[model samples]
Target: MDMQDIENKYNKLIIRIPVFLGLALALGIGIGFMISIPRKNTVSEQSSKITEVLSLIQNNYVDSLGLDSTANFAIQKMLQNLDPHSSYFPSDDAPLAKSQLETDFEGVGIEYEWVKDTLFVLYPAKNGPADKAGVLAGDKVIAINNENLAANTTQNTLFKKLRGKKGTSVELTILRGKNIQKISVIRDKIRSYSVYAYAINSEIGFIKVSKFAEKTDLEFTEALKKLVEKDKVKKIIIDLRDNGGGFMDRATKIADEFLEAGNMIVYTKGKHKRYDQEYLATKGGIFEKGDVVLLIDEGSASASEILAGALQDNDRAILIGRRSYGKGLVQVPFELSDGAEMRLTVSKYYSPSGRCIQRDYKNGKPYDKNLVERYKNGELLHEDSIHYDSKQVFKTKKGKKVYGGGGISPDYFIPLDTTDLSTSILNLMRENKLREHASLFAKNNKKILIEMGLDKFDKGWQIEINTFRNIVGNISMNTTQSDYLKLYYKSYLAKVLWGNEAQIQIRNTQDKAVLKALEVLK
Candidate 1:
């Protein structure tokens, strides 16, 4: 009952591994093509035959690859023929994959970055595990649970080693300056806020929503209320830069706040009539009549496109920036028998003016890399590089022409600015030397920096060019590079404390879109 039984079980597992691998491999094909209820007879028959073949292969395949791995590989390859957003999440990875939308993670809270193959502590979440255990900036994370992560480690590997269920503990070996110390960290649930910027000034307000997550609409509405209802600002700027959207309902809610009742916020269509739906502003909007400026960029996608397209098509707000990321496919989730989750494209979203903001994926896989092609074609640097067909054009409520071949072309296109940036400057930023310097400055001048606040610090406080040159360590900086460094330092310095809203609000002074928007507003 001992060795013989174990050997038999192992042999069975090895023989049946192919099915697991095939199921995993084919997982991606199920994403974006999910049917909640059940498939038709023909579809059912097709699935049965596929399963039978996989079973046969599992029992007789010469190689004994694990079932799950083989299935995952097959699914991944299959998805290449579909849209980019549809994806498969293996059972072990499903939970963590949903962390961003969940807006929290079970882990010892800390912001971290890997530089030159070594993990560096950016800052610990206040009162979180690392902070509570005396982790410090400039400290090198050498090992986790004495596994020695120093020589070779990826961000993914390090993150997995650190995160677990709440109240679980992990040991860390840290090298701070000269001394090496071992610390025990207890992991806990850490909440991540999506709203990165908000402020009211000059009879105008600004808010930057980084992503559309679970509470994004709540955050956006609260931020707008703070600006309009509380501060009574005449105009507002909603910055949706780098927002790779989340829930469609959440985006609809956010768009609803800015649109008048009866306005079409967005709509979606699928093969089945049930998947077809429309969202409209059901009530009077909060800032319905206010002069609004929406800032979007190449990174703005999904629900981001919905809100921006709604506002733009309604002629409610002026879009200021480069074209948004065109991702209009709607995904529905299904759980596999093995507990893995799949997101399949069930529908396609359309902006109010009837523009499908999905970029053409017919060319091939890696549709997301269209941005790179756009850059190569100088689309980022010039609007002339963007070829919009007349058939794809639509008129706003105010008769303003908007193109929708893919992505929203802003009313005001702000070209990418790489001027005054050099290798030296990039190196400084890459190393986060300014962030490191700012951390030290914040510690040493915590009283003064905080007392001064970001506004005062930006305008009045003088950290000086020499301070940057000294901390950055003899790096040759031209005048442009030096000036850029000063602003970079100022931006980091503006963030006297991590999570301070003042940083973005203050740094907008240097934003091209903000400046252009101000011109239009004036």
Candidate 2:
């Protein structure tokens, strides 16, 4: 062939060869698709699939579904898969959730308990809306805003009804003995103090911190001031037994009060460097010179752990009770575009000894059932049952060994007391008979009890065994159980008449952990 004829043939052959190879490649792909199993979805694909499914449901579903609700639920489920702590709060629930850690909220401000579908006023908060409206303790709430509370009326429903925007009014029909009185209570801002402090004796002061909130450090400082200045308390017991924690800064601030200057309180490390930071104690700590003891348990978590870990690692305080709730994860709240809020776990915190106290959540293990597992493994009752990670050990400032990969173990372990937890006692507690009995006793002798006061009642009053038997109805109990029942009755009575502080004071007379704390302080 000539040069031109050869060039034209080569170009035509190249085009034909590609066409043939493309056909063969298409055939091979079709055969492979027919025989191959489906592979797992990629991260991006799975996420897109979720959005597509949600869109499809919104546009084409048979029934009308709330888009916000659906999206909120999906977000909640997604967060659940990430960790136990990360959570999504809907717009309606966000305020209430945040209010738990707020210093105050607008409400009628009466602590109540439901007895036999009847809402009983435990006590109206001093100078609060209900108190200003002359709502008395022992009053039964018959109705709210003319809506009679039925058997189906839940506590949450009642709470919503009682709480409203500032300057709003809630009309309550209260049954105070035989008199049914209609009272109009104007809801106003009520202070919800997180710290309850009182001198247990001449030398020992007890402070119970329910949670870390916006004003927690201020409240704690005031508490310490009173204990040290007015009460002349040389030792203090910080009771953080069931505090679930709140603001990290509040906890670190309280830790600073106990720790000396320049001491590292806690440090956080995250994927992003911005979330990584260290909290150190500053100068002029109020209670730096006192003998300090902290009481913690499985319910004590997050900020509670932070404070306890700081004190224990520095040997500044003795921790007494069960191991703390193992949560070292630091969550930061982010507001979504739809006004919803999400608390995402951003970092893990460590103590001064460089130990992260977060327990293992690997292999899809049941993390929520950890406390139950601890109970099952006899860890709560026996110190020997605790399985510490051998390789995760760290030392305190005093060279004492502490372990990570779990929680902050106390220097002294107080076993969970099941001594007074008899079947009869349990039944009484479950049936609310004990509280009912206490309520009735307080009501019948309200005048006498009020006149005599908590001190005299603590010193002289005793529930007769016959009276206890009559209230509980044919349940047999040992002397120990009976004594415990009496103690509880008195404590509940004290709570109804006085307040939580008085109740704690009464209960601390028999509280093993409190007793241990006092011993450590001494």
Candidate 3:
């Protein structure tokens, strides 16, 4: 073949193998395959050597090993040694892993909390198996099929017992108030909402994006319109505190709703030119000019940073909270014929300010370890504690300074409030049957509470000490002077009476980070 033929062949090869990474689509989750077959001779030689090694091991090794399993293990380790984010998922696990970032999953459909090694139902998914079976929130799960789990149980065990092939059934015993009853539920797929929106007050709209799932942007649009109609909301807060991230497309679409057309939302770069891409905001945003604030913390990463950094860089919103979880590398998925998948890092995503928010990985420390080190180094507690390479600094559109090689530093840093964790009453609340108490309270007064609505419930809600004593059977544990018990109590009632959504709005009324956002809006 002539030189022209060689170039044509190369172009065809590149086109056949699509670049796997979609910017921030799965920062920490994306993967791409890079197999360079350098001129034919070297390629054949290396391929033969690898094949020979595998053959020798399979035939001559003393220990017997399954060829497919051994090959998969080697592939996984090879990806791991390359970077922290690259991962391999087996055939059985790949689908489940994908569903986690999506909106729904097959299960019993109940939000639950563990207390004292016992499982307690929080809020059953609407129309879900648990709800259909009359499983109410606060029902303490004592046993599965008469196999008592209260003594030796874990989240995994609970999940194993509660979830199964859709349309299957499981037996459970629940303790509701003074009554214990048995219930059987058929497992089915459950919808997991990513966007939670509510009016914080008449003036401030609160929108919490749990993760940038496929439907998040659509959910957010509907929410924005409702807020716009609700007496003209003056300020909006987008909460991404613990949102690790999901689809980059969803995040960028949401960001577009707050930015003018022609404005850059984010961009990505990798070693290969094909990996370069840029996203820009389109025209006609619902709240493009409205005052906005983004709430972030150590858990905000990837798509979270994409939205916050875009807004902050464009001078469209104020970031209020702790520093974000730094995750800038992008990956793309390469599916194996065995139904397994390998996610390979392909590029680094840059915030609108031109900062790649990935923290240093040169030391090969895991992200979890890095977080622990941050706490030890006083970085999370103090802004001055943040150490970054001065040379990696970048400027936002409005001339504000930003740094790379770490995460996005909030414009207004708020120290985490750990008082609740240490508060005896709070610990007691978590460890005790608070969920059951909430459930019973809502059940007993459902008619009256429903009529009251969230507004009236918040204003006139009362949890008498006598009532509290009755709920816990007057079980005393610890005392706290914190004074948040009232709100906590009310929020639970709201959850049981209405739904999980209503409960969050009520709880946000007292959330410290949320309060800080409101103050900033003021």
Per TM-score, what order, best first? 1, 2, 3
Query: Between prediction 2 and prediction 3, which has the larger lDDT?
Result: 2
Put down candidate 1 lDDT per residue, 60-106, tens digits, no spaces: 99988687788787776666457666777778766555555656678
Q: Give the clashing pairs for model 3.
A: 30-331, 30-332, 31-331, 31-332, 31-343, 31-344, 32-344
Candidate that beats the other on lDDT, 1 or 2, i.e. the better one: 2
TM-score of each candidate structure, all chains considered together: 0.87, 0.85, 0.83
Q: Model 3 residue 271 lDDT?
A: 85
Identify the candidate with maximal lDDT: 2
lDDT of candidate 1 at residue 478, scale 0 to 100: 63
User: Against the true structure, what is every candidate's RMSD?
Assistant: 9.6, 18.8, 10.3
By TM-score, is 2 or 3 better? 2
Error of 2 at 385 (Å): 1.0
Q: Per-residue CA lDDT of candidate 2, range 6-30, in tens?
A: 2332332233221121121121112
- Candidate 1 residue 162 Cα shift, in angstroms, is 3.1
Consecutive 10-residue window with the lowest summed lDDT within model 1? 16-25
Ranking 1 against 2 by TM-score, winner: 1
Q: What is the lDDT of candidate 1?
A: 0.73
